[model samples]
Target: MTDHYDAIVVGTGFAGAFFLLRYLQHAPPKARVLVLERGRNDCKVWQLRNRRTSSLNTEEFFINNNPEKEWLMSLGFGGSSNTWWGGVARMMPGDFQLQSRYGVGTDWPLRYEDLETYYGDAEVIMAVSGPADSPMPRSRPFPLRPHRFSDTDALLKKTFPDGWFHPATTRASAPTGTRGICCGAGICELCPHDANFSISNGLRRLHDDPRVTLRLQATVEQVETSGDLARGVSYTSDGQLRRATADLVVLAASALFNPHILLRSGITHELLGKRLHEQMPVDVCLNLRGVKGYNGSTIISGNGYLFYEGEHRRQHAACLIETWNSPFNYRRAALRAERGRWTERAFFRFMFDDLPRADNKVTVNAANPHLPEVTFNGYSDYAQRGVDRIPAMVDTLAKALPIEEIESIEVARSTSHIQGTVVMGNDPATSVVDRYLMHHRIRNLLVLGSSAYPTASPAYPTLTLSALSLWAADHLFTRSA
Candidate 1:
């Protein structure tokens, strides 16, 4: 490997993959890019055969004792992409200006309009299947049609046409050359059909490019900065210290490690590692009276925005509702469900948005620099209030559909969406990176992924952060060239 490179991109998940893909396309052909990955490049077959995303364990890189808290992620060449369920949704226009519109959290430096084109771009790259109609505005339609919705989702959509609709997802609705059609089996993490989008399945070409040199099992330690610019990065590989210099450095390591690397590099903004969080998820089961569910094409068949936005967000957090089609545990309850009427229930996931809290954060492990100390203080009253509104929300659902009893409502351990920590805003005093995700102190350093999120929107972060990466690369290199 060369001692110098034009650009060094870290992590190969949605953020890094999208950034590097655009960088290679927009940059001159001779431009040399170095890709650093903390995990090894394990292909889809290996992951499936082994029944695991990586050879490495989560605790090996992160240490925490926050009671009842967990962060779900895969740390390999594909990063968390290997573990996601492939449900993609765009942030509402109001999500960008939570403070301005609802008088609650802080506003993002960029708005939904700024990212509309790039959202479309990311959708096109993944060939996302979505509906012609969307709750949020879209400049262009999705590349593929929407996935089939369950009977419950059909009723919900028919009742509330404005919000409830099929979720835009990476799980293939139809057969593609690289992916098989989703069998509606709901095993997205290690999809037996190879349906959902993963780095190995979709964006492997980004690393395989002749101009790009990919180094796996290389853990980045710190960004080498000089004056107000990021020079490169220092990392370890095979128990040997290594250094690579580049004109540009992209930190795509994720919410946990991005802030840790920044702290290790001495870029200690007061809020650098603060507000380490993800959406608070609550799972609900509805014992239906007449509705029969479980007829969708993927795991999460529908999304509901009826309770997602509006003036209520001023007092409490916004909510995003997800309707699940595949109840993996249906067989376990078969005896109680009556063999012929087994599909007469609906499952849901209610995700609540949260504001940044300084108490919840990521810190450098005192014992091991390779590991991160994750501390979570817990969700705020706003999120709790949103959770408290669940019964009322269920009442709204009952108004639309047949009367049913709520079988269970339990808070999920984790959504695996690790966001915040390294927040992005126009203000340098309060934020680590700017609107373009460039470090406030270092010009050439760009921190990619959900780590830049100022506030946790009820919507999914993968598509938004992926769009931001595309927008950042486009803004930096002038894609028109």
Candidate 2:
């Protein structure tokens, strides 16, 4: 790493990579940039094929306090984007005004329009595909057309006319540039065709730029701050403790580690590690009579926003229901004979928006202080309202389509969309960062990624988070220039 640089970015996730690329593009020609990644960038192809490798290891630096609720994250150069399912839904307009519109959760410091251009820019760069008629008022249409859905998704769309639509995703439908199109590998987390969007893909180009220095296997221990200014970052590489100075430092390490780094740096706030939450995945299986599910796509197909907002939200939390078009999850070894009749078994997935709670937080474990501990209260009555209404939704679908049987309805898993540890707002007393994403106490320090979210929308947040990062980069560089 350089002795001193114009900017330093920690972590190489969706946010970090976007910020780094933007910063380098906008920064003065002579300006230097350094990126510190905790994990190495080696054998990415091998990791994609094997499923389990050094790149996808469970982070030992953090542990979940609730055994039932796990917070999974990537430790490699690209971070979670390396293994993301590639869903890129934007937050609904109501998502920005949670407090004003619904009288629940905190409102974002900026509105949807403020980030609309950045969303468009990021989407175009990432090659996202979706319908322009999406519920959200976007400034422009997606870069590519929406993916062709499986027969099951088409049925869901016809049955639930008003609520359903093809999802905007990062998966490539047709060959674009050197990136191959999706072959419906069904294993998107490990895309075999290199079609799925990953920050690592961008980092490969940034690595070749002379202005940017990519430092892998370097763990940033703390951000050094002096009298409201961020000095730089201290990280360890090759068993040596090293400190690098920079004019600005951005933390995109993620929701869990970003707060841990701040707390370790002695930057204390009453809500530093508080208000952590994620969209808990709710699972339900159905036995369809004539329709077969699970073809075409692997993970996501389409989604329903009918329950996203209503008078129902006044009493219970809202949820976004999506169709799982991948057959890999529901396949049984003994059921090999039912390959073509795939729609016979189906899984309807629900992502309930988890409210931010002061009690649910990420903190250093008392037993092992070096390892982070996440404490989350599963769900509240708000979430229960969504769960209670699922059966009725199933009944509606059953009546419309060939009826068979409702096999099960239960809490399945989580999307690992860790959010709100270092939330942003206009007021520092109630938040961690300002509207520009700069730290309240440390002016030159900015925290990126989902960690800056005030609340977790019931949809995937990758596109939204990438937009936020680009917004931050524009603000940061425009002022400096």
- TM per candidate comes to 0.97, 0.94
Cα-based lDDT for every prediction: 0.88, 0.79
Residues 1-481 of candidate 2 have per-residue lDDT tens digits of 3499888999888889888777877888888889899888745577866674355467567887778777767778778777777888888877888889888877999998899898899888899878656877877888888887666678767777777788888888766674678776576666777788876664568866888888998999889989889999999999999999999999999999999989888888999999898886777777777776666453677777877866666666777877777656633321224556545766778888877888988887778666678888766566767788888877776645565777777786567788889999999899999988899888889999888888878888888888888888889757764
- Candidate number achieving the greatest TM-score relative to the actual structure: 1
Candidate 1 structure quality by residue, lDDT tens digits, 1-481: 5689999999999999999988888988889999999998878888888999898897778888585898889999889888888888999999999999988889999999999999999998888999999988888998888898888899988889997988999998886678888888867788888888888889998787899999999999999988898889999999998999999999999999999998999888989889987888998888887678888878889999999879899999889999877868432331126666677888889999988788999998888877789999898888989999999999999866785678889988888889999999999998999999998889889999999999999888999999999999988976343
Candidate 2's C-alpha runs over 4 A off are 330-342, 366-368, 479-481
Measured with C-alpha atoms, the lDDT of residue 153 in candidate 1 is 91
Total backbone collisions for each predicted model: 0, 4
TM match of model 1 to true structure: 0.97
All-Cα superposition RMSD per candidate? 1.9, 2.3
